[model samples]
Target chain A: MTTARAGALLDRLGRVGQFLWSGWAGLAGLALFAALWQAGHERYGDFILPAPLATLAAGLTIAADPAAWELAGQTTLRAVEGFALAAAAGAAGGLAAGYSAATMRLARPILTVLLGVPPIAWIVLAMIWFGSTDGTIITTVLVAATPVVFVGVAEGAVTRDRGLDDMARAFGAGPLARLTTLGLRHVAAFLFPALTVALGSAFKVAVMAELLANTGGIGGALAAARANLDVAEALAWVLIAVAGLIAVEYTLVHPIRSEFERWRNAARPWGVKR
Target chain B: MTRETTDAAPSLTLSGIGHAYLGRTVLDAVDLTLAAGEVAALVGPSGCGKSTLAHIAAGVVEPSRGRVARRYRRHGMVFQDPRLLPWATARANIAYPLRLLGLPRRERRERAEQAAQRVALDRADLDKFPIELSGGMRQRTAIARALAIDPDFVYFDEPFTALDVALKRRMQDLVIEAARGARFGALFITHDLMEAVRIAHRVVVMDAHGRGIAGTRAVPGKPGGRDDGTVYRLVAGFLSDDPLFRHIHDIDERRTP
Candidate 1:
């Protein structure tokens, strides 16, 4: 029993070690990329390109400023709100299209049109309606993200096991029960990937829309930095925004995705080791 | 033995049952009756409408032309594939049909455990996902799922085809034992005549064209005393001498020996 307890502890430690190794490898790759960027800046000079050290100093300066946090908060809020709205709408739409052939046919043309129109084009429309505000940023993010979620969920719905559905019917599972137990379970797998991609897209689109509309966010700070030709500060703000994106993706999106896919991951070769 | 209720009606009936797929005739004017507690096997050639007939009986596919009537309110099925939900645990898969019946969670779990025990599935394996299981284990889970609801009628479509000979025999025994209790009637489809004879009270042979039921033979006595030798002779006799059974077994003989 003591030996078995020791073995279990060793196994736990081994998993932690593997996780750390992978995390370090990823960090090393990012560091290497940054070093190359710094070398390129040294060759080109600071006006056109900023070194990693200069960018980091500028980032620290921005981090110290209360206004920078306020702008970051605005961008974060808009992106999240847009993403939440897009997820709800897309899931509802996807469920409808998945369950009903008529709804799918009717909605296909409209979704296609919406998906085909570029995020930038939507920003123009948003600007016309909401005009240089958070609403414009949110609308742009919504247009860019909803289709990813919709298509993900629709594909999931289409691929649902007819056998299970038949089993459910044989057992007299009501429509609502079927949807909750079988339908949602299948769709959950696709929904996470869709949400992850949409969330990332939401951040990028929200920031870009803010930059274009001159709204009060990190995008406006980027615009100001560009206007002043403060290349290091601009690069720093870009890095800060990217870091925020990674943070949100890791902390929010990944945890939810992992929770939904824990069973799936447990079946995978690598996932079994952990 | 409990006598079948005379007023209960037949568990299932197929009269003048005919089916075709994309202009190819599979079953023709097949007439079959399954009283409550009867276990019948539909056996024939690969292209014979055994599976198609099973599908028709299960209401997964509509018959091209025929009349099928069932007294049972609930029916369960096991396919050639395990067909358990990849996302769900073995217990959950077994409980799935019960969940549809709106059984409370406690009742569902209890029934699932009982069904798994009936199939000789280990209690430890209950929480394991389908992907975590071996092929035989998965098939056992499927059997457990089908039996979990204590279905009045069950349809099995070549369910043990993937199993090894030993595992196949074990599963056959489970089905035979389950049927003997009179809790369920089953329409079992298979190309293996020996398998049919081992478990079925009556075996129906379908025509190659799948147009209809061509022939049927009753295997006398309970399946418990029937050895493999008895099953082989029965299949061999049907293959060579029985005129009604001849066509279905001809192709299998050419392929096997």
Candidate 2:
């Protein structure tokens, strides 16, 4: 009955509409990518690169098998677990580094070393340590992805809006409250980008580690397909891993990230007409 | 000469307040005082360190060379920017200080709504994020947040410099109305002489380079209900007669994009 209630409902609806509209844009962009893939297929032919439609058929056929589903599930679980652990450790380490100068000085060199070392090297070490198990895959993913997240979050903390911090201090906000409200939120800006990179790396490292360690996952399936010299099956497994990564990104990571970033869409250029 | 001390804390007192950046002096020997329930406006040109003084007076910045005293249970600061957390709703932003005070969720929400009402922010606007609200609305949210804690003192550091003429006056009225019976003192910083004359009990002028006070003009009667003509006349007298108010207009002109 009240206008305020009505306005609130309208604003919520408007936000939902904006979200779906952006989703459509994302789909449209994917369609363009599919079109490019189809062009590549036409040039390279079926042996080198399958047609987009043919690849879709192959992926569907592979998905119909329950064993393939189990393999896909294993790979997804490894990637997600590794990402979760890395996120926790990296965010904690980065916040410490950001909040304290001594930590930053100590961490900067170590992070640089970790980041500079290749994932292949880590996967090789994990294979020697854990010996052909999920441990090898998860360890490789964590080592590969943690520094990426740590660097992003640390930079975000360092560059947080000091003006906002002053405003908070004036309002009698204690140290902990300020860290949660202003400090963490500022880091959220950088957190999402780092997560995107970490997510991709998690999947890549998981698969690479699995293939090296001969653990059971999509990577194993790809190795089997390669041994059989079956181009379609190998491509199908690759497509399945990518789809899984994308699903987790959309369903898990993105919704939370969008909540924090909704404010960014509202900052418009001055003097620009609506 | 104004190295003042009091056994009991007054609203605010600063003497011989000076600041410098990397051996370059930005302010020197600036003295100011505000009584409880009184509002004093510090008017100066841009870069004159009026803001720096407001910061020192509010204890946000330690004066490089001065003794400062503040006797207030709680202090509020309204920055030039609203500085609302973009991720937070207006209600959340307004309730932020109360949350710091460790009030319950329901009580904080209630106080936030009450403060929003004081600033004439409708319930609908309270639910909007700072970005969704207009610039004036954001500033009002900032004001509401500042007043929600019921502070004994407020430092308004050029908080109304960004509003349109109509919005600016409305906000000024909200401020004066809020301060009327609250008994909270305020240090209002501005480069606008008319604005200072309209809202402040007294206006302290800081000249360029911020070395010392150029002049202090006491506004007759209370802050509100003074005729626009009277305020205008007083402002005109300052511009021509006081060297400090002369460049007040120049600061206004140079920064008017």
Docking class of 1: acceptable
Q: Which stretches of candidate 2 lie over 4 Å from their true place?
A: A1-70, A100-113, A266-274, B1-9, B15-18, B23-31, B65-67, B207-215, B239-257
For residue A151, what is the lDDT in candidate 2? Answer: 91
Give each candidate's interface RMSD in Å.
2.0, 1.9
- Assess candidate 2 and give its TM-score to the true structure: 0.84
TM-score per candidate, in order? 0.87, 0.84
**For model 1, how does the per-residue alpha-carbon lDDT over B1-257 read when each residue is reduced to its tens digit?**
11223344688988988877687666789887887777888887886667878888888777888898988867888989888888788998999888777889989999999999989999889878898899999999998888888888899999999899999988999888876764688899998888888988788777766666666678866666788778888878877877877666456533421
Tens digits of lDDT, candidate 2, B1-257: 12122233567778898998777777899877667667888887788788888877776676789988876778899999999987889999999989888899989999999999999899877767788898999999999999999998899999989888999999998888888868788889988778898998888888766888887777776788788889888878877876556666554423322
Best-fitting candidate, scored by TM-score: 1
Q: Tens digit of lDDT per residue, candidate 1, span A237-267?
A: 8889999988887667766666576567657
**The candidate that achieves the highest lDDT relative to the unseen native structure:** 2
Q: By summed lDDT, which 10 consecutive residues of candidate 2 chain A come out lowest?
A: A265-274
Docking class of 2: medium
Q: Which ten residues in a row have the lowest lDDT in candidate 1 chain B?
A: B1-10
